[model samples]
Target: MAKRRKKRKFILRRVIVVACLLVVGFFFAIKVLDLFGEGNSKSEESVKEESVTKEGFIEKIAPYAQELGQAYGVKPSIILSQAILESDFGQSKLAKKYKNLFGVKAYGNAPKVSLDTKEFVDEKWITIKGEFRVYATWNESMDDHTKLFVEGVDWNPELYKEVFTSKDYKEAAKAVQDAGYATDPDYAEKLIHVIEQYHLDKYDS
Candidate 1:
């Protein structure tokens, strides 16, 4: 009888240990799930913050772009889109330090900085060192960008005339591409995509 009692106690201890282990495992799973939920929430919040910052940058430049557009007959959407693309939303080292938003090259005695740039050449992309213009402020950079469309370049006095006289943003983007404003083959497409994605055409009104 005593042996049977001891056997019963041993089985009971085993049952209790198993129950405790199950409880601990259940709690651990819940803790892991909570941590994952928190991580997702934080990630979503970070995306939201990044979006807000981008929108803020756009708003900051909109006024100047619009004013320039009105004065020069250039599309505000084109100006804003180029700025966003060239400067990477005003975060590029060139834009931040030198204030050259359009990647405008320096000529003659103008202040400039030499930077590594990529150009599409002979159906392939290649890295090249080029000199870019330096500006005192973003406004100056924007003004010069407007002037490029208004006054054109030294080689072709009417190079960018179509860009300013375009009836819509799409035409202007195509004009810019045709005028060889950028070496990228998809330059016009990129401008159109950005203008549509951000609703930049609203500024043209």
Candidate 2:
């Protein structure tokens, strides 16, 4: 009778252990589902926020700046300030004509859209289709510009790493110029000027 009692107790303990494990597993699954739901909600909110329009051109590019900053670890303000200067807030002739916001050129028979051409090798200026990054809208252009800096393997990250580390736009621009990203001696000065002129750094934070 004592042996039978012991066997019954052992069976009860095993059943309790199995029940505890099942309960723990159920709670863990619930927690995981809650986390996944929150993530989806946040992603949807981001997409909706990106589609909204704000008062100025600077506001319009804020989302792009953030995406670029996240991608390259560079301050978005610097990129936005440079874009404003380069494309005049998307009103430049090149932007309107060829969608070339960064002044990138086509080489070696790549497909291009012909804009007015200039002579390069002592030959007459021929109507040349300039190869440019194409986008469906200005927002896409801004997004692409950020991606170019962050993902472009052709450009060295070391050149902008110091600049990106600085939170101040002036420091960042100066670092960029000092690192030889552009040939112009006044590149930093010009970038700073544009940032201040348009209050572009407000988006960085």
Candidate 3:
């Protein structure tokens, strides 16, 4: 009789252990399912957002290439390419935040904007209160970028006058790079890459 009693107690303990394990496993399974559901929902929302606005951003900036080609005698291809490289096709943190498509720094009475990091210049990085052109929209940023080449002090007037006399975008882009408008070693190459990749030259002619 005592042996039978002992056996019954052992069975009860095993049953209790199994019940506890099942409860823990059910909670874990629910938590995992919730995590997966949340992940899928967030991914779907991201895809929807991207689909809605990606093309619009591309369209809005497209006109600037032609304008730059006409005004600066720089190939629309080069202008478009350079903008893409500098701003990562308008997806860069700086471009998104400041609307500075050309990565231009304000020289004179322009309004100043604070930057989290210093910009490289004269072979050194310096921290200073710098001015950047702020715009109401991406289109405004692209418009200003074109105007800068046409009317800004950054480019040498004499070089532009001589090189762009033909009003050819290709020649003008090369001249601007040769004249040291930017210190980047691969600036010209990058512009060419962008132009070829996107066939941006179509906008010029």
Candidate 4:
């Protein structure tokens, strides 16, 4: 009888030990699953943040700029930087309402809207209401912008020819300014700053 009691007691102890191990393993597995879920949540949040930020604006325009750059021999960085500055990330009234991202002026009965614009003149800035071209889409505006470099102004067909022949983005920015693309004295510097700030030149190749 004593042996029988001893055997039963040993079996009970073994059963208890096995149960405890199982409980510990179950808790550990749950902890690992929780950690994995949290990691995925963090990754998803990062992606969402990227989509809503200024970098998002750059990404949206980069593909089009790269395509235009290849077709026109223009630097994508220069085009992107100009769009950002001129369109205010597509937030300007001209960009939002008219899809005119470059502040391009209309001439000879082309589609246009009169809007207030600021121009640097005589070592100062002045606000002038001017007629700007209207476009059906951002792509149209970007195409027209490229054509300005390729076709140049009415007075000089080669006015912006230097912009197309430049070796680098910095040179292109300077060339645009030298060719009088904008009246701002710091137009070239602003373009260079924006290009470096966002690593815009990565799309140049």
Candidate 5:
């Protein structure tokens, strides 16, 4: 009877150990599946968002970008990227209300609208009502953008001179930042990201 009792206890312990192992394995498998499922879900969400947003913006501007790029001897990709960034895929209030794709501000009381714009100043973003140029059409906006690079800002030819001469899209991006195209320190990086993400470089050709 003692031997039998001891054998029963041993078997019970073995069964308990096996049950715990099975439980652990089951939970681990569940956790792994959860992780993979979440990852895939997030990836699918990102792809969906990209597809929706990419369809409307550049497609409308590429013809103008290509033509102006050729006329001004600049990379079409850079021009398109600038428009995409400044205009928020041509959906920003400034772009919508004024058809301003490049965020070119108006001076000397030109036809313009005072829009609430954020500018990076003193290492922080400050809100200011800036005067932005209004365009009759998007093509006019693109034309004015090209003229800005060719004719320069404030009638000063020094600005964007390197950009006008750059042979590569990347170089033109750097030159744009160097010429103070935007107050954001990461302006070039953002442009490059837009350029690469949308394959805007194809227009550069």
Candidate 6:
């Protein structure tokens, strides 16, 4: 009976050791997974941050901008510069995820992307959750931008007529500002800077 008891005690000890090992292994596995997940997340963020810049953006979207600008009589340089300012060189969430480059407000039967955005309202900047328009492709977004000018919605029709008829990028930018395209008050100056800095006017020709 004593021998049997000793045998049972030994088995119990073995079982306890095995259980402890499995517990340690499970915690270790979780730690490893967490490390891997964090590494992948950081790398993804870094890639996103480096994905687009003015130089790269100008080359990538200039063709589409030119085509759309030509179709609508809008200066491609001004269009592209406005696009850069509105969409942050197409790196914004609305641009990357929804392919919306112009930051048009959501309306009609179109789908939407709800995001917090800053707007100058009543002479003050306010952050509000806004439903931004979404498009299936970048071309569609450009097309929509052109349409917004051709046929204004509830906001304002022919809002940028002066911009549309402008002879040059600077004039176009000034017209957009005069039309209240942005509340920055220096919207035209900034756009002119962008147009000249990247030589976006070359696309107009």
**Number of clashes recorded per candidate:** 0, 0, 2, 0, 0, 0
Which prediction has more favorable lDDT, 1 or 2?
Answer: 1
With a 3 Å backbone cut-off (N, CA, C), the pairs that clash in candidate 6 are none
Stretches of model 1 off by over 4 angstroms after superposition: none
Candidate 6 deviant stretches above 4 angstroms: 1-53, 154-156
What lDDT does candidate 1 reach at residue 66? Answer: 94
Which numbered prediction scores highest in lDDT against the true structure? 1
Question: TM-scores across all candidates?
Answer: 0.91, 0.54, 0.64, 0.75, 0.74, 0.70
RMSD of each: 1.8, 18.7, 4.5, 9.0, 5.9, 8.0
Clashes of 4: 0
lDDT of each residue in 86-120, candidate 4, tens digit only: 99888899998999998899998999999999999
* Tens-digit per-residue lDDT, 1-205, candidate 3: 9999999999999999999999999999999999999999999999998755644555667776676567666556656666677777678766888787776666567654655545557877666564566666766776766665556454444544533554555565666677666666566776766666666667768
lDDT of 1 by residue, 1-205 (tens): 9999999999999999999999999999999999999999999999999899889989999999999988888889999999999999999989999999999999999999999999999999999999999999999999999998888888988999999778999999999999999999999999999999999999999
Total backbone collisions, model 2: 0
Which order, best to worst by TM-score? 1, 4, 5, 6, 3, 2
* Tens digits of per-residue lDDT for model 2, 1-205: 9999999999999999999999999999999999999999999998776444212556766687787777667787787777666666656777666565555454456444545533333443345454555545666566665554555436564545667567588898998777665555677899999878767777777
Q: List the global CA lDDT of all models.
A: 0.95, 0.68, 0.68, 0.93, 0.88, 0.85
Query: How would you encode candidate 5's per-residue C-alpha lDDT over 1-205 as one tens digit per residue?
Result: 9999999999999999999999999999999999999999999999998777766678877988898877778789998998889988888988888899899999886799988999999999999999999998889998888888888866687797898788788888999998988899999999999999889999877
Mark the regions of model 5 whose C-alpha exceeds 4 Å error after superposition: 1-50
How does model 3 fare in lDDT?
0.68
